[model samples]
Target: PAAAADEPGTPQGPRAPLHGAAGRPAAPPAGAQPAAVTRTEIIDRAKTWVAAKVPYSMTAYWSDGYRQDCSGFVSMAWKLPANEWTGSLATVADRITKEELAPGDILLFHNASDPQEGSHVVIFGGWTDGTHTAYTAYEQTPPHTRRLDTPYAYWNNSAKYLPYRYKGVTAGKASTAGAGETVPEAAGPASHGVAGYPGRAMFGPGADNPYVTRLGRQLVRKGFGTHYTKGPGPRWGEADRRGVQAFQRAQGWRGGAADGHPGPETWRRLFS
Candidate 1:
């Protein structure tokens, strides 16, 4: 029953990074672009980063830039298509559905009821071997660099990176049509394309088995969420599940229930 979800003193898990091993936020690889980064590539980079450190918020470490919050992180990670990219969590980037997620998918963690409420962002590294990790903007994460690892080891509150990671996909191959295929056209001076086309992250398209940590972070934030709240182990569980379900119901999800997996139908509603 939903009431059971509200149980206090529920066990949680560790904070997960949505990006990569927080090792040393390396400079973007030479000529790193979408064409070179397949969806699989995105996940690979994230895994490397996570095993190192954890992704942090630009606001927390560095402030005043194009992206400042969770969604902003997504913009930076996937690197938007252009400075004119039209989307935020409330706009373009916010259209993710659970099941549609893959590695490098950005998950926007925000207050469920407050439309203007700010949120955190985590890149999905979908499930792998019954465990998952993420790149996160955790407060303790290093300043101004993509951190890696940050394991979730749970199955709740995970968010997905939308449209961004899916930039140039053709069946399974990374699309190399336009140079602006993978990342945004406004990352740095002389924005370049990957290989032949502009590509995105190396994390795989529809990448599974490695992006669940972001989902776990989502659960931790809003699950038993409250002002200045903390949980056990950072793994989102009963409390987090309840919060996620409530958001889904408000979004008009059918038969809103927390069953762990964010399926396509679940995403359809969230995207709507």
Candidate 2:
């Protein structure tokens, strides 16, 4: 593939892979890890783990859990709660569901009081019959898989929820589940190039990275026009952040909320 070239005017340049920017084949995301064990199996095992260990507040740099907050449980289910950048369980719940939903989608429920009590979440691990079961890491509640239907409080209350479906879950791409389990559709990531810019430079400090281009793509989705161009730029800095912030403002994210600092909320909404 890399070695093959064009024959005369055969339009023979190396096209980037679909996974990369502008079809520019990107190296697979770095530091990526194989998902630990079969998800449901893990959840089933987690119940025993929760029973033995004491529940502590989540204190990872990415999470605000004094120990095992609702969002923290989801983060741990995906093994990335440490990837947190905000204190809002809403923010965490929003990000996980920002993608699509499958067997491993993380679910969240919130309250207004105790972290463990107010914010409760579960990791979707497929269904046992028509019932939904989840694996969660909590102290007050025993860790393990649970079915919230019959006696489990029948979840889905007024509290908002989001499910994060990890890529490459079923097959190499994505798949749809049958019946009972509710599957979410994808919000198209900016797969094609936008007006003006069309290279791997849109994600730089001023412009660079597929993730940054994603930011611009989000602006476009929210009904904003690109003031500049497209493609991955150089680095993600001021001008970039400003562009993002401006887009957020246009989206009516106010009250110092969407400050363009570019954290989880920004990515969740943008990537959503």
Candidate 1 residue lDDT tens string, 1-272: 34322312211111222233343243344333433244444443343334444444333222222233334344434443311112333333335454555555555444445423333345665433224343222211223334333334212333322223344422233322111123342222123421221122212223222223343344445442331144332332333335445555555544414332233333233323
Best by lDDT: 2
Model 2, stretches more than 4 Å misplaced?
1-48, 51-53, 56-67, 81-101, 110-117, 131-159, 167-272
Q: Please tell me which predicted candidate would have the highest TM-score against the true structure.
A: 1
Estimate the lDDT of model 1: 0.35
Estimate every model's Cα lDDT from 0 to 1: 0.35, 0.37
**Candidate 1 TM-score to native:** 0.33
Candidate 1: lDDT of 23?
30
The reply for model 1, stretches above 4 Å from the true place, is 1-37, 40-69, 81-87, 93-97, 112-118, 130-272
